[model samples]
Target: MAYLADTYIRFPIKVRNASGVRIWDLDGKEYIDTFMGIGVLLFGHNHPNVIRAMKEKMERYVHLSNFFLDEDAEYVARRLISETGKGGKVFFTNSGAESIECALKVIEKFRKRNRRKGKIVSFVKNFHGRTLGALRITGFERIRIPFIEHDTEVVFLPYNASEVEVFMKAETVDAVFLEVIHGSGGLNMIPGEVVEVIKFYQKKHNFLLVADEVQSGLGRTGKFYGYQHFDLDPDIVTIAKGIGGGLPLGACLMLGELADIFETGEHGSTFAPNPVALAAGRVILQMITAELLEHVTNIGKAFKEIFSQFGTVRGLGLMRGVELEKRVTKEEFLSEGLLVNIVGEKTIRFLLPLNVSNDELDEIAERFSRVLKV
Candidate 1:
């Protein structure tokens, strides 16, 4: 309902059902889906394991409020910690935006408690979420201009090594939010020099580092956390999108002593840590294991080789953007039955599933070739 609150871009097709990497519309027209509900379904639509986990949880119980305990939460939390090795303590949320909200609060509280300066430095083109705090840190000026939060202090800088080095030298910074691969910003990857600067400065500075892995995490990037590729361990990590396997679940993982700042009454969500979503999360974590990670890396490499013949492929693993030649347009791809998105002017994005088979990947590549040829 983009019109309902002016929240999203409206589409014509009304989806009915899906399995693996294919989706069907109400009239029974089928297409290979890589949009995957904007990257939430990393395991693809109606994944049997995830569905079964949620179903079993539903049969047992659903929401148990924050006051009561849910057994599945422990399993999910443990898995997150083991996967990323950063979630010393985790706060559950309903979406990635909420996870960002929680991370912002944690760092904000940490700064306030220590009497430090309060400024958030984030790169241009990196999107955290839509919540007030997350919105402030979001880099794109188009969407952020009208909804500016007056009280929050945020600094925007170019995603380059020189700019980052200069900014890290500032004492006024409280936290730095980084997205390793610029998902919405035309799938730009961070340069090695910039990654080095951040890694070195992460030690010299006391400012908290928050990795916005909402789109790039959960084995979508061939690594559990995108920042892992940078050799940078963030103080707080926000995860969502694919974590719930299609359900609305997310987490803000805090590490070390920074994990214990919030007192009992400082933060919470009533419906968060829901048993059903946690069950699905547990299953997804299990699904994206060592063997699966290796498969994703190998497949991603092959897809990049194939897509390079079409245009520039500019992202990691399943999170990719195919920059089409001037002859092709996003509208043309949509008309051709390809389900990828047009991000920026020249790029056709691939929000492909993490668990999509090799055959599905080949089919997607073949269709893109068709888009270019026709």
Candidate 2:
């Protein structure tokens, strides 16, 4: 019997320790961690460099209020902004939801400054964070139904290229927030043409384009940012999950023009730029160089080849999904001792760690094939 809140259904596995591409339960059973802590362990569990950075920063300080600027935070911010290539500034926060909140503030302030009462356009199956404002913009009905009261003036459109243009043209929207590769929405991939459509509409209407890269960034999708796949340059980008090397950290990156709208006291978090988290983030980002990205791409190709035997494979890089046929049920497959995530009733999503080995991939595929046959 476990002694914790019943908020989450306890899996049979009680994790004791985790390392690259694998986790061990207290019972001494090991499993390949394809889910990768819901896409947080981008560099895999307890990477040595990340661990060393965290420990070194812990000796200096852990949590300093946002009042004082920390050097670690500045270092991370500089690196992130440089990667964006848009001369954007960054605002640090502690979680994905907080980062969304920061993005919301930026959008609202931008609209207010322009004297426009425009709506925020989101998609039909998008998943932003769970805060009130973020939830309002989120696209999943099951998650949004309970909190419908908090959402207003938000327009939802189909995740298709034609529909996006039609929606933007018809509605006076201030911004359009999307996930370049939809993670919680069942590892859905946005069409490349749809991205071109978004860019075209943004140029025509001057609405802000926001990409939620919380799950798809930091080499998760073969690129530093998922938007890179679509050749997109979003006006604002929200990042978290993998940014802090398994710590609680998030960041909102915006172009200098859009960032200027948020004046002093506009937004802040108490533990936003925690030194320990930023230190780890720095190491993780450094490790995600050209060679590591190539590794991710190669692994993604292998995932495609293996998952194709099951059914259709969707998504890019380490963020991918294997959609089992209607004949396969997720409940029936749980007895196989592997921890795969089922979304949208049929898709078995693999948020595989960036460094997952080919041998581990082979094992996962064999186990999955065996379970699928059963």
Candidate 3:
């Protein structure tokens, strides 16, 4: 018996060890891991290259404050900035929520500098994060109520292009934060036309366009970033989950003139740029090149074909959700030894790693078919 928080009473799976698309429970029962640490293990549990890099860095150092710049930190940041293709700068943090905080702070600072109390327009059912400021901007109210008093001046809008002009014309609208493909908010895919409208509004109003790619970045969505699904360039993009393999690391990439909004002391974290985590992030990114990305995409297509037999598959690349029938619940599948998660009551979210093999994908699909039959 484990002494755990009541929060976990709803879904209890005591893991003893995990590696490569599979995890073993405390009772030695091995199961395929479709959740992938909530989309953190892009290369799967204990990837060799990531492990080697982290071990090497551990031998050198572990926790160094942001006061001194580490080589790995600089390396990862440079690579990320170069890939963003927007002349952007990067600020690292320890978690996705912190990265959201950094992004919000940058937008707010930009507003303050421009002497505009602009409002931030967010889409309905978009999940940014759960921190105070991030929670304020998040479209979900169940998580926002605790900090309602401290919420920012954010306006909720439908995830469609037709409503863009009206919202942008509203007074004091400063930035637009969105997830090209909503992940936690039910794997909802934003229409390409909606993205085009956002670009138009950003050009017309001069307000910042922010893409919250925390759950959709680092090749999770068949592209380097989810925004790539649409022909658009955001002023700022936040990322986390798969960046550091399995380690905790988050980054906020700022583009155009918005990159200079944060001064030296405007934002930071004690473990933000830990060399070990940065090394892991760099190696994981290298492992997810064109070939691996294609592999993931192909496997995703296969999985979708199998999952389509059950219900609609909603999402791109490995960040997909199988919307099951009302009679089929996510918890039912999990209890049957498949490590899938619920996006909602009727949807089983599958965040496959970029390096997952085709054979493993087939096995998972077969198991899922069996479970769904039950």
The residue-by-residue lDDT of candidate 2 on 342-374, one tens digit each, is: 778788778887878899888888878788773
- How far in Å is the alpha carbon of 24 misplaced in model 2? 1.5
**CA shift of 3, model 2, Å:** 8.0
Root-mean-square deviation of candidate 3: 1.9
Query: Which 10 successive residues of model 1 have the least lDDT summed?
Result: 327-336
- Displacement of residue 47 (Cα, Å) in model 2 is 1.1
Question: In model 3, how many backbone clashes occur?
Answer: 3
In model 1, the runs with Cα more than 4 Å from the true position are 1-3, 149-152, 327-329
lDDT of 1 by residue, 136-236 (tens): 98888888888893545788888778888887776467788998888888899988998888777767777788988899898988998888888887889
Taken over the whole model, the C-alpha lDDT of each candidate is 0.83, 0.84, 0.81
| Candidate 1: residue 195 lDDT (0-100) | 80
What residue runs in model 3 are displaced by over 4 Å at the alpha carbon? 1-5, 149-152
**Residue 65 alpha-carbon offset, candidate 3, angstroms:** 1.1
**How does candidate 2 fare on TM-score?**
0.95
> Tens digit of lDDT per residue, candidate 3, span 240-311?
888887788999988888878777776778778778889998887777688877876787788778778888
